[model samples]
Target: MAKKNSATKLFVLDTNVLMHDPSSIFRFEEHDIYLPMVTLEELDNNKKGVSEVARNARQTSRNLEEIIGTNEESLEKGRSLGIKGNTHVTGKLFLQTTALPHDLPMLAGSKADNQILGIVSYLKNIHPDRQVILVSKDINIRIKARALGIAAEDYFNDKVLEDTEMLYTGITELPEDFWEKHSKDMESWQENGRMFYRLTGPMCPNFSVNEFIFYEFDKPFHAIVRKISGKTATLEIIKDFINGKHNIWGINARNREQNFALNLLMDPDIDFVTLLGQAGTGKTLLTLAAGLAQTLDKKIYNEIIMTRVTVPVGEDIGFLPGTEEEKMTPWMGALEDNLDVLNKTDEEAGEWGRAATQDLIRSR
Candidate 1:
């Protein structure tokens, strides 16, 4: 492979990066990658177990073997990453073939991290015009590299979102003048007692299906985008679950957000729903209400199966004796509390009726 230009970066891989994601080699796109000898040694040391980390290590070894092949000459010169149909990777892969001096002070020379850092330092010196950066998942390694005046960064390919604010909230608030701006050739009708509107405007193309849109102006409109074709979009008014008449299993939504969540949960067309909120936000309550309404009243589903991670807050109370359900009973305090609230929602139901309702819920 020919030498890359100064604009192309050379990334030094740490063992933890490969162990976290084996395909990271192909993820750098046009940037070249370098693997230190100590990184390969660490991969070999960790490839014995059946755990996920071990599996990744073994896979990385396989990928390297396939890239290297039987050619020894290309080992000294960098191998093209695009050799094995990896056309997306336009850069080269370099392996540490010769030993470099590791005389950096304030770092233990015997540590694998230090060895990788030494390779990075040497590469930076050799490639004066090119940018050589160390990509690592370990924070301490990155900090040490920066202290030694080396460029280092975390592997960002695995992160879905760098900022939490970028996450989609599944709901969007329309501008106050949304109706006026999008009313051009707007069509409205009722089908099966559900009101729907079809409108064309500049913003119609940006609407996505199943996304809830609400306007809290004069009419306080709330609807979900049902379809989008060309520059036209169709929205159907969502059911008002906050009304007592439209309550789900004797539970009415206390707020608009909870109503939207209940709408998603009760929609048979929607196969999956994810709710995000802080504690005491009624997430569990709304979910249980919708699930009970669908499973019991509507007969839409046979049962509801709820599971949560068994992680404890503090020191764990180990070794509970019983069957699977019994062992999990200690962690079901939240479920019990929520069920008590749901059972009390039926004001007409007497104490015996509430007990019988609880029995039915537990049976399912």
Candidate 2:
């Protein structure tokens, strides 16, 4: 209820938070962690069996034990988590032993969620000078805490990116007047069938190797920032993958981003390729098409090994039957679907040829 300050605050962690990240308690650099007794009970109850949840529960128990040690007295007062091994945690850990008085709504019931909420309210009421926040991974718990006027939030320490839209696209669009401003002292030369321009300007600092740069004012220009020497940058025109002789496996890029992606994807010199996009954005299709072109057509690589992280939806249908490939067939549905599109690229290649190509791909 109090306005947050620079002083170290108290964070009441839920069982799911600990299970999500066993090292979460230490992630709060200067804040204190308060663990309710019910959270420990939940962790203990879950610390059986061999599932990921069970493993996480066991790890959480171990982490708690290592933090608490053999001193119950220290925990009662407050145990400093800044041990020698983990000097990052400049905070203390507290354990709730005595029951806290609460005025939770009767409809809330006496579940673990309500208990954690009760403890948060109690901590807020007692520690009026400090901020008390509840951290959990459960959406419903967060909603309930907010309804009860308790400050609650999701555990974001494990987030890869706070916003996917903010991810860099490896491309920068130059201003329309870029040439008018920075192309005065530019020098040009042609070598090995590629045109390179040496431009010295204020934009050189913004240039990085392999970053795509394009300008579309008056005369359109599409180039890549190949190198930078002090205040000068070398810009090489990108080989048009659309209509030029650079099409990949009958697939031509339609847009600037797609062109950039195709240039990177089909480059045998570039070993690693990472593509990020939303569904229906042609990420898988483009990657597979490039892969087929390189592996089956050009013989750039011996084989293409397709793999994905096996995240299950709902309850898993345990123990799929078949060979390793057959068992993984369900997960490779996206690859198969994309292959269907790629196979149609060669219309003259009859049904037999398509089937043969599919067989060759699977065999590889």
* lDDT of each candidate versus the true structure: 0.90, 0.83
State candidate 2's TM-score. 0.80
Q: Give all candidate RMSDs, comma-separated.
A: 2.1, 4.1
Per-prediction tally of clashes: 0, 0
TM-score of each: 0.93, 0.80
lDDT of 2 by residue, 1-364 (tens): 2233538888999999888888888889878889998899999999899888889899888887888888746356677788747898888888876777654765366788888888899888877888789999999989988887889989999889958679877888899878877888789999999899999888888888888898888888998888998989998898888784666766778777788888788777778878776788778887888988988788888988877988777888688988997898888888889898888877789899999988988877
| Number of the top TM-score candidate | 1
Name the lDDT value of residue 114 in candidate 2.
86
Tens digits of per-residue lDDT, candidate 1, 244-351, equal: 899877888889999999889999999999998889998998899889888988999999999899888799989999998899888998899999999998889889
lDDT of 2 at 238: 86
